[model samples]
Target: MEDLTPDLGDDRTLLLVDDDEPFLRRLARAMEKRGFDVETAETVAAGKAISTARPTAYAVIDLRLGDGNGLDVVETLRAKRPDSRIVVLTGYGAIATAVAAVKIGATDYLSKPADANDIMNALLAKGDALPPPPENPMSADRVRWEHIQRVYELCDRNVSETARRLNMHRRTLQRILAKRSPR
Candidate 1:
């Protein structure tokens, strides 16, 4: 495969993965202006495939994907392209999740509503410093479980309310929570 990392005239390439089309297009254009040859993927599967086929200098991944967690994509990239730097983004930002992404080999994490400049700065700083390892790995399932618990708590254990908040069915929520609880 051809080199996907842009030269920037300085020799670096950036890969961006997000399910948001508008955001991905805008960010790609912006990065192109800054001389980054940006390769984009709209799903975790696509991102993993692309990263596996290409040599990336850096990667920016969204935490939530259409098919899987963004952290999973980052993990695959980290394992496949160890020299590439990775930054994870999320709209549902949580310290625990961010730490988990880092623990899984992300170079940094950014909450949603991040600006282009912030993204650029992060990409530029990719190789300058390394983030400390996470205290513990956060399983994607565990994070989802925590989200379910928080929603249940907020809804006062009302399955209907929790389901409404989660955009799921009350029965589904009940089943998930039941599975999470001890027998």
Candidate 2:
């Protein structure tokens, strides 16, 4: 057998896992510019598979993926590379998920729309200078609405199926979908 992996040193390597291809590509480029040799995966399976071979020295994982939640990926990275610094990013910012991500070994949790600077700062911070807290925390209703919208999108905008999957009445799902997104 041969070691097929590239010779990127741990200090210069980064693993970035996210479902959004555009975001993943953009971030990978930005991180590479910052001197890391970036490796990326868009699903939990892919992320886990990468983790199995050689643990990354740094990782930035999305909190939500098309296939599953990102915390599971974070856990795997933590197990594979206990010394790796991990950051979890999400579009759906929720207190519960942030806490969960941290507890699962993420060094930082950032909401989506985060620029490369924000991510880089979080990834590079040396256990000092706390990141600014969200000015407006997401309300429970807003979080619920976002989850419903995500599921609806995942179900290809099928109201009936989205409702069924959510175990909510179709009419209620329709009403929620019809309403404007909560702040």
Each prediction's whole-model lDDT (CA): 0.78, 0.84
Worst 10 residues of 2 by lDDT: 1-10
Which numbered prediction scores highest in lDDT against the true structure?
Answer: 2
- Residue range 1-183, candidate 1, lDDT tens digits: 544333344546778999989999998887777778789999989998888788587889999888998887787788888867788988777889988997898877876656666676666563656533343435678767777786787688889988998899888887898894422
By TM-score, the best candidate is 2
Cα RMSD, model 1: 10.9
After superposition, candidate 2 runs with Cα above 4 Å error:
1-10, 132-183
- Measured on C-alpha atoms, candidate 1 has an lDDT of 0.78
Q: Model 2: per-residue lDDT, tens digit, 67-158?
A: 99888888888998898889999987789989999988999988776777677778777776676655566788887887888889889999
